[model samples]
Target: MPNIQLIAPCLWFDDQAEEAAEFYTAIFSNSQIVNITRYGEAGHEMHGKPAGTVMTVAFELNGQPFIALNGGPAFKFNEAISFQVICQTQEEVDNYWEKLSAGGDKTAQQCGWLKDRYGVSWQIIPNILLEMLNDADTTKSQRTMTAMLQMKKIDISELLQASAE
Candidate 1:
């Protein structure tokens, strides 16, 4: 592991760290729950959690380390930061879009972005979207960008057709 990844991202949840960790592990491939720590009687007064209640969950998603904290509802997820899942095929994009967006805010979806049930935003983007949008031909790139702007989940076929010379 590199020093950069040693500082893994920590996600905050309102008393749902274990549940969220389980959900994420189930969704992403090559993932597992590493460890879980629960609150004890030693700090119940400061933490406000009952003894043995889950305080933190450490897990990895697609080999990337992550920590889920059972923090209170003083914070909420917004669009300012999001994890980007770059996919090589439409099938991959569609699968992630369907699973992650289940029970999520549908109206918030636009241009390959969706907010999961936990309110964490994700971008299920097709790798081709970048290639097409970055094409040397300005017209094709513009067309590809326009087509991408019209859909919630990325469609590689449409993006390819839009960029066709």
Candidate 2:
């Protein structure tokens, strides 16, 4: 048997668990749908789902395991919790941002954070941004933060320039 991750995030969705899983798998390179469980006639009372309806979808994004559940609209994804994707280059950041935010909420995009079409929040951050923000020079760090706050998609070159100034 394949070794399973100790912990995995379970996403609650109204009825788009499979769709969301496919969307996410397409976005990440080393991703795939591991398994899918459907609702059976045994528990139609509590779940209110017909037999054979998709109840859960197990997937992996870049090797990180996640389970998407069709648990009705009782819960939603909010900014309080987010998955951060650290990119080594600007091209990587741009690629993820463009693909993840294709049909997402435009207004929610700020400081490299965006809400996807399925309402999941993602932070597309550059690796250098973290280093610059944690640098000993407060001026450089502050400048980088200020520059970052003013943009939706993170620009690594702009951050470098701001930090130098």
Candidate 3:
């Protein structure tokens, strides 16, 4: 039996598992590809994948283990499940937003939420968002929520300005 780690997110892709794994490893710190599994003749007929084709890739993103499966086009990524990227600064948020949104569905981008080229939804959140939303005063949090809903990318300064109102 494979020594599987407790629980790790598995991303499904249409023959782009290796590409997606490479993309994510480049995006986050403390990341690397741990292993890659290829299909073999034994399951070629059952899986319908050619021998030697990539089956899965195990990788780490910000030290979190994840697997990307080249599971074909029977399924696709949707917005129902999204990965939240908590950033310490607006620069971090902007950088990720720009990188992740490249070649993706730009029309679907709003409220700091965007689908990457792989159709994977991601939330690029500013760290201050938590503090703002958790403020002791509900009005401040409400105002912050209002500000957040108005923008495509989160603006820390703007959120602060709204909280001040």
Candidate 4:
């Protein structure tokens, strides 16, 4: 077999690393738990504690690698950087929006941006959004962008309608 190496996004949680990993894996298709390694006594320096205490977890979401670290609650997910998921259809957008918005604050911005319960920001955008943004007609593209700027989560149909006008 070919060398199977994966570099995943490692998330640090305040004692909720496992919970968050499970939550994320369940949300996306083609995803599953790969491994869960706890801290051990010998690896104190690696984890700042004895080994066997959930030092790292490896999981996959839609074939994307992700790791969760049970680090103490020193920092949190902020709006500065967010995961942008491009949906091929409006239904996909709606599904992610509904699921991610659970127990989280929802803000409707022009293009597409919403904050989840974990205080993590996400942008649920339609796949065609980029195409519309790069339309040959600058005016139309600007109008679409303007419409998107006014809302939080993007509605592809609405954006297309706005661009047509």
Q: Among these predicted structures, which one has the highest TM-score?
A: 2
lDDT tens digits by residue: candidate 4, 10-58: 7778777788778877789999889998877775765585556677788
Give candidate 4's error at residue 87 in angstroms. Answer: 0.4
What lDDT does candidate 4 reach at residue 57?
80
Steric overlap count per candidate: 0, 0, 0, 19
Q: Estimate each model's TM-score.
A: 0.94, 0.97, 0.95, 0.88
Collision pairs in model 2: none
TM-score of 2: 0.97
| Candidate 3 wrongly placed segments (more than 4 Å) | 1-4
For candidate 2, write residues 46-158 as lDDT tens digits. 99999999999999999999999999988989999999999999999999999999999999999999999999999999999999999899999999999999999999999
Name the weakest run of 10 consecutive residues (lDDT summed) in model 2. Answer: 42-51
Off by over 4 Å in 4: 1-6, 43-52, 107-110
Better of 1 and 3 by lDDT: 3
Where does candidate 2 stray beyond 4 Å? 1-3
Q: What Cα-based lDDT does every candidate model obtain? A: 0.91, 0.96, 0.93, 0.80
Structure candidate 1, residue pairs in collision: none
Which is the better candidate, 2 or 3, if ranked by lDDT? 2
Candidate 3 on 88-122: residue-level lDDT in tens? Answer: 98899989999989889998888989999999999
Evaluate candidate 3 by giving its C-alpha RMSD to the native, one decimal: 2.3
Total backbone collisions, model 4:
19
